[model samples]
Target: MTGPSAVPPVTVLPVGGHGLLVELPTAEAAEALHAELLRRRRTGTLPPVREIVPGARTVLLEGLAEPRRLAEELPHWRVPPLSRTGGTAVRIPVRYDGPDLAEVAALWGLSEQEVGAVHASAEYRVAFCGFAPGFGYLTVLGAGYEVPRRASPRTRVPAGAVGLAGAYTGIYPRSSPGGWQLIGTAVDTVLWDPERTPAALLEPGTRVRFEPVDSAGTPIGDSADPDIPDPDIPDTPSGSREPR
Candidate 1:
């Protein structure tokens, strides 16, 4: 009996009766697969699409009338040239003032200004969005800056708080309980704008940059965090970063 699980690189795993998790080798591969699947859904090549949640190394395709049928079409999935080529670029101006900035500097062996310089100088892309609506996990394009999450999460993290955990950086779209090491905060861009059409300002494959800005939206000057004792990070990237 040839079931839908027969494929070359894809491995289908059941996520209850209503969902299916498609596993890929790397984070980039999963993103590429999600992009392709989204393209298929948009062009009516696949069945009525439902929730398509992409993670670090997996894509969740839920609410399918028949996941097995969709799985049968898996091996043939492909992304077009233009969709793969161009991405939406967005620049988010931020203030390099966070409670955990000192610790991150201590861990990475850099001053606060140096920390801000290192961060603002990098080109990051939305690798995946999770944890909350509008919260996109950004990936550093070049030699990545890796920082662990807080050993013990804070009771509450403010909205627009820019943080780093694992190999990814992200902005808290709203006030929420979180543990990611806060590095900065966005100036003006609305993250999860429910009034807007798409809502989330960031999406997978979207190019992003953290432009350092001051209170009046002018260019920021150098600064450093005071020395403090703080430590703790999840063992893996997408481990236990859930709000509780």
Candidate 2:
């Protein structure tokens, strides 16, 4: 159930309907496992596991004929490393015109320009996926940008909305009710047919940078934004960044 510090811990528990609960160190680790399982299923090493659900720090493995078989198989399973260049970067145009824009600025004691810099300045890691389908809770926003969620969540947060709450930032995959402070918007298709390859544009461990746009939601100029390497992806420590 536990591995060395370098290795992630694995726990096997029973959820209703015979699901195997696997606790991971972080969502990133769980994601790596999910991808690895998919790869193994294709390559024919691991047996067909079903309903691989990812959570904040847990991965639920379902449809194992016998829970003991899962426990024995766990020792042979390890999270695989994804290709450094295997994933694509998704660019989203943001209008930078949210109603809470000014409020967020004052909360962090930053000018509107400074606030924009913090949001657009760094690449974020998809730390975990939660709250809704296709919604990513990205980690490592510019340092001083940690703002709490709104006192009350919006009745309907439009799809493609880019918002920040606590130390995380995310895009609304659909029109969902939530409390993250809206800052901008992303037009990228966050969700679609789950049966399709690369079902979601955002994958775990992938990097993303916010590009500021105008009222029309077009790029700053001809729509080009520099890519910042995901500092959290590597073992190296991430540099300091301003808060959201």
Q: Among these predicted structures, which one has the highest lDDT?
A: 1
Model 2 agreement with the true structure over 142-201: per-residue lDDT tens digits: 446688899999999998888989778888888889899998777544553478777676
RMSD values for the candidates in order, in angstroms, are 8.7, 5.5
Q: lDDT by residue for model 1 over 29-133, one digit each (tens)? A: 577778788777889886775798888888988898877877766756653322323654698999989989999889778788677777876556688898999
All candidates' lDDT scores?
Answer: 0.75, 0.67
How do the predictions measure up, each by TM-score? 0.80, 0.74
Model 2 misplaced regions, further than 4 Å: 1-5, 81-84, 125-130, 142-144, 188-199, 203-207, 221-244
Q: Which residue pairs show collisions in model 1?
A: 151-231, 151-232
**Strongest candidate by TM-score:** 1
Q: Which runs in model 1 stand beyond 4 Å of their true positions?
A: 1-8, 76-85, 141-144, 220-244
